[model samples]
Target: MAPVSALSRLPTGAKLFITLSIALLLLALIAIGATLQTGRLADSEVRARLRIAANESARNIAIELSGDINALRVAVAALRGDPADAPSCARAQGVFAQQATIGTRFSIVDRSGRLLCGVPLDTRIPDDRDDPVDVRILNHRGLIVTVAAPGGAPIARVVFPTAFLARLVGSGSRAMPLGTALIDEDHSLELTSIPGQGPLERTETVQTDLGLGGLQLRTSIRSAPITSPFLVALLLPLLMWAAAAGLSWFIVDRLLIRPLRLLRASVAAYTPGEVIDPGKLGPLPAQEIRELGDTFRAISRTVALHEAGLADAVVRQTKLTREVHHRVKNNLQVISSLINFHARGAPSADATAAYASIQRRVDALAVVHRNHFAEMEENRGLNLRSVIGELASNIRATAPEGAGSLHIALDVDPFLVNQDVAVAVAFLVTETIELAMTCDPAAQIRVAVKPGDEEKRAKLRVVSRAFVESETLTHLLSTRYGRVMEGLSRQLRTPLHHDPMTGAYEIAFPVMGRD
Candidate 1:
């Protein structure tokens, strides 16, 4: 393999290297992005899974709790129906328990929030938060425990900080309605390994001195699915580029470069356009090389037959070169036109803006094509600095005097990009320059594309050294409206972010071309 810095200097090698590098970089970036996204998704999925587990566990516990409480209720009702026990000042006590093998402890609270009943010795809890309850315990901890009471006012609070209870319950505490914790409610924390978060909302109650009573029921779930499709979207092209580069390099180097070098060097002794002798050269190693040598020899004989054919040859080559370039330009224009058509048809402002950004990138390639003359073998790896500077100049030329003075400074190497990506970045620079200038009449824009941490990573930065105040910028950066910034992000395949203090809007997009 060649050093990266050296690859850009070779004729066809540079373009190939650049194309591969970009593809690899994009693949790396996408892989990284996908990995990151997947990691996040997996974490979220784990959380959701845990939450579901917790909820299911809690729901089962709730059912068991209801059964235990109901059994106690039946006992109380049976005793009460006896009339003598019904009016007794006994304040009936019953234990809450479950039949599942998973460990569980039960506790009961009276109408006045007093602890009444059978329970494990370990737990120490308030029978009721509303009126004041008491509890008598022996062993406190067990698996799959539950606490419930018939009287609604007296809430049940279960505290499981013990090692045994902690092991039994994966994570998360179960709370009953009208529960009290010496503190405020209405708080949210994103923790892994906890679920239920079911249809529960927070409602506060003013209890006479029993601290603050609040019921925090499971509300709507805030969990998101773990797939980041955008990261995948950015990766597909990178793989194609990699496969293309690998195959092209093998073919071009063996078939075109090396053999041609041997032919030109060996045939140098003969006159320019002379009738070459095939046997004069050694037997070619490969069939293709031998065939090319023979073809060159035949060409020499033909050239010798008609010396005047050289003029016609030059004319034909020139015509073909011009035709090829023209067709490429027209092809680029068609792509740009298509992008524009889609952009105009976009239904929302954000969608339109995204399409507009896409069109701009296409336009940039179109500009490059416009500047390239016929006969230029490859426009890949075109100087980014020159293109950027020109793009900035173009924005200034089209805008007002104050905006037109905007200067662009580029600090990036002449990395390779295909006509497609190059055009897009060009438009990005143009759009950034124009927008930045418009934002602040005296703004100076600095656009830089630099290699990032890994080979598949690149950073395209457009920053303005200007002062403009707009609340819309904050809205643009908001998570609620992040999708609205389609233009900047679509071009970069990254994200658009704005820092309030510096008033800098940075859009980092992934480009399929690399170092």
Candidate 2:
């Protein structure tokens, strides 16, 4: 892949668009995840409610059938306890026959288990108690459910969820089947739809003994599954994602991308030297793009003014060059005349000393004039080579060389310095070299010119090799030379590096860029 920085340099609008698109995609993914989790939770909750409802229905049916059978068993016992031919016994049988459906039918058996009177009086039931259950079940019960059958008096058996309950069982497609059975004192099918068996059944015998043989209660179990009802179950997350994408597009269009496009257009038309009046554009509110437009306008105004001022300054500088040249001619003539007067008169050694002293001052003044004249001729600055070489030549001739020859060399990127800086350097070099020569004439002194290393961070070095060995010179460098060098470095927007190793002084400063 290309470097991220290379791609970043593409227009800001493109960057913003890509970023916005990515943000929207991430938002969509998050929404979908949240939705799915919510749907799962919702499903669980709904299923729990359904399960509870199903259990309630099943339990209610069991209780109703059991209660009815209990009532009938009490009535039958009252009739049997009376005389066998008694009108009450016959009346009880008549009442039973009137209410007899297969669900309510019952048989009264003698102590030998022989049928006495009722529907299925001659029929036999399956011996499920002796038959092993094929599938194991989690719960078990004997005959009665929610209550016990009265011990041995009158046996009653009942099945729950008659056809009537099934008719009202469900609301639309959510219906589930639930059935149950209970036995009481009256041994009969107290609540049942018909005589045949249903496809699904759960039968359990309550282990507690009844007054008669064991009785069974059969029930069907059904439940709804559980899960979360709010987020994913409703598909709400998809709607939110679609809405967020629309918002992202709207935001990028009105607030971010369009302004950047306008800025790009303005930058395309910009050029350095040519005059432009961005003022033709009107003022705007202080948003970033508007502020940028205002900055461009100000920059155009400043650049135009600068170009005109530079052209005018060029012509004025040409005129000043000629005037400086005339002044230099006058100063040289005066110095020449003074030297001639001194030569014509021969006095004592003291007199000669005084004359030489006067000549030295004149030479100093002449160096100053030469530098000024050079600056004027250049129009904008002083030539570095000319100024340095001239100063070095002057120092070799007059600065009381004690015991040695002086070596001076200079190097650079072949450039010039500002007039003021160049003149100061020229004077500084001359004074420093003179000070060195006065110390020891026999000393091997070297001044070399070389380009500064860009990686070195220091610009230039004016090295005086032997002077650094002197404690006095070290003090002068620290207190005086250091301050002067630092001031000049600041003015030039650079740094000076000074290293004094034994007798050597290597001073380096940051280089000014060549014009």
Candidate 3:
């Protein structure tokens, strides 16, 4: 069987119905059990009452029989000194004349069981005393009480008719639902209120002591079942169950089910991204449902306000970004112009070349700044080949008088880097070209960029056909220019390699992606 706790899975209405049903069922069972128990108690009470009635009847009979025996003893005492002859017997009969009745005779028997004297005498009785009994109940006749005379005269027997015992038990009353019998010690039925009413269902018996021995008065009562009475009593519990069920349904519907249904309907109709009106749900008697509706309305209002604020912030941030990039582009153009003017005013060839190189580096910055503003939305830094092409053009534009034929060839892979790192790379290329011009001034320069050992790193190679190999140039690279390039390499977090045999200058560095 499933565990009882699975009942919790039932709906609210079903749970209420089942709970009330179980409670009523138990109450009905208890009522039936108690009613059956009461029936048993009633049966017991009837048995006790019947036994008491039989005992009382036997006691009354004993009292009356005792009185009769006393009267016979008195008569025998009166004849104590008289002779046991004809006149004596006649006198004895005259003495007991007042006590003669039907089923009760004043008879005197001698020591040999002979009838000595009698009132209304009949000679049919034999002079035999073969069997003796103290209290003898005769079949359909009477109750017999035999006793010996007080002075050892013949035995005197008092016979009380069956009508007397019937009167003692009140057999005619409707309250007495019993059949009564007077029985001997051997359980032989001598006299009964109902002579042939089959066997009794329930019997109670009491033993009574007469002068000779004892007799049993057995009374039996029929069974009185509780089924009919229990059925009659069940109407009250049925009515109780009806009342409880009605009240429970009323309370559950009013306080719980109806309100919950309303709440569910309101929730299903709700739309997201919109403020909900608390008034839509109106009111509910249940406190928790009312509070839940209030909470939902508050949440919708808060979300709407937060979304409005976020939109405003995005608009302000975009405007500020465009203004900053515009100012930066204008400033870079002015700096490039100033560097060109300074180069034209130089007095010597070496000083003019130096100024032109500085102007080229400035122009590289201006080109990068323009590209940055153009692709700001892409945010992928600067394209490596585009920056290199801008740097090569700037170098060719600033070439000295006869060196205008100097050509820079480019073979570069596509990649991206942030503004700062791209500028650092341009400066490194500018320095390599200046170093090539210092060695042969007329050599062609080749610059190329490609993927490095890992995806996030890239190598830039600058090769030149310069054979000058000036010792002073080596000294400048080691002492002065070495520090600037090494510092740039440290900022880019990569090492720079210089190969004099191939005139190959290479730097490998981690590239930062913008998107």
Candidate 4:
């Protein structure tokens, strides 16, 4: 059988855990992707809203600053009417005050850095600058716009309060939470403070043509609220997925895997001739599992019934076989008695010897049947040592009167042969011993059954002077005895070997046991 792998040996729970873990990992990846996509959408939406707010704030700042610049230009034109004398500060201030809105102030200075006109007598003119129109931010006076002539000399300066610019930038209602700031791009200065206080997450800038120097508006927003919704969206599904996976594992383990494990255990413990009991498993969680267990129990019961029937049939056959062998053995004994009775009445010695020979052969067969019957329970085969030994003893006891002093020696090894082989071995031994006694009345017959050259084989050898090529033995071979021995050897499936020099008759036969 092939060996099972380590992975295959793992329990159902461990395999389920691995499967669930892989699913959870995929779900985690999906959650992360969803969270990233949600954050991108929020950022895009916030960016769009911030862009609109910044654009709107920049436009308002630009429009307010444009009006202030145009008013200053009108004041400058009014002053340019007289070129001979410097415009009177009182007259210039009067023209600017009429056009200027509340919280607005103006200062007019000549090419020599002397104050030419002012709304207030103590109004300070800003330093000379090059741009025709420039905007600056002051901490106390909001935005300052300086107008200079084509000669690169400042002609006038307008001061717009920071409160007025803040009002212009804060004109409209916002769709989202945000902060706004008006910046002087030239100086990198903030004209108005951003609306909200703490650190901002997103910021956008919009440039405006204020007819002065560089000026722009910045809009910013915090993303804490957006982040809260994104986290909820990402976590909600993941939690649900985990719960569902856990529930699935629990259901499968209880309803399917656990009941199957129990059924497997019961099957492993099953033995032949015993009916399997599905009720040992108690109540199963699933109907399918219950049905499977019941099916297995039914199959096991059917097999057990068949096995019982086969066992009973085998017992009956064994009894019948043994009875047949017993009857045959009894009949052989009766025939031996009849032969004894007939030989007792024979008048000639030759006839008496013939009867003795027939009795010996009959006894040999009887011995084989007895041994075979004895070993039938195991069917291992008859013991060669016992068969040959008993045969040798019987031949010596029934020796002719003159050959009564015959010395027959038995040296046999313990080996087993089937009934057929045992019969052949017995007959061969009986013939050789009888021939030896007939040729030499006092012959020392040596019978040996020993391990053969090949495995599971044994050599039955009869060593005596009768096997030699003597005239008496040759004359005896002309009778039916020599042919009978040959026939027995053939039955054993091996040629009988006679060594003239050693005076031994040998033939090999198969044995049940190893050498």
Top candidate when judged by lDDT against the true structure: 4
**Candidate 3 on 9-108: residue-level lDDT in tens?**
7788878877897898689778767766877787788777766766676676667666666665654554444435566556545544544533446665
| lDDT minimum window of 10 residues, candidate 4 | 185-194
The collision pairs in model 3 are none
List where candidate 4 sits over 4 angstroms from the true fold.
Answer: 1-40, 54-220, 223-229, 288-309
Best by TM-score: 4
Cα deviation in Å at residue 363, candidate 3?
1.9
TM-score for each candidate, following the candidate numbering: 0.30, 0.43, 0.48, 0.66
Of candidates 4 and 2, the better by TM-score: 4
Q: Residues 1-515, candidate 1, lDDT per residue (tens digit)?
A: 46765765677755766777776776667666776676566556545544554455445434443454445455444433343343221333323222212334343444553544434244443333433222222232222223333344223333222332233323434432122111124332211222433433322222122111231123222343323464455555666667777777877766666666768886776676577766665555578777877887888788776766876787799889899888988898788778678866888866765665556556666677765452145534455555666665545444554454656676775555555555556665665554565456677777777775556455667777552346644343353334444564675566665565565555543443533
Listed per candidate, the RMSD to the true structure in angstroms reads 39.4, 12.9, 12.2, 7.5
RMSD (CA, Å), candidate 3 to true, equals 12.2
lDDT for every model?
Answer: 0.51, 0.48, 0.69, 0.75
For model 1, the stretches where C-alpha displacement exceeds 4 angstroms are: 1-321, 324-366, 371-375, 378-380, 401-407, 465-469, 472-488, 505-515
Give residue 183's error in model 1 in angstroms: 99
Candidate 4 residue lDDT tens string, 148-246: 666654477877776666666763343454555556644444444434545434444345444446665655654434345666787777776777778
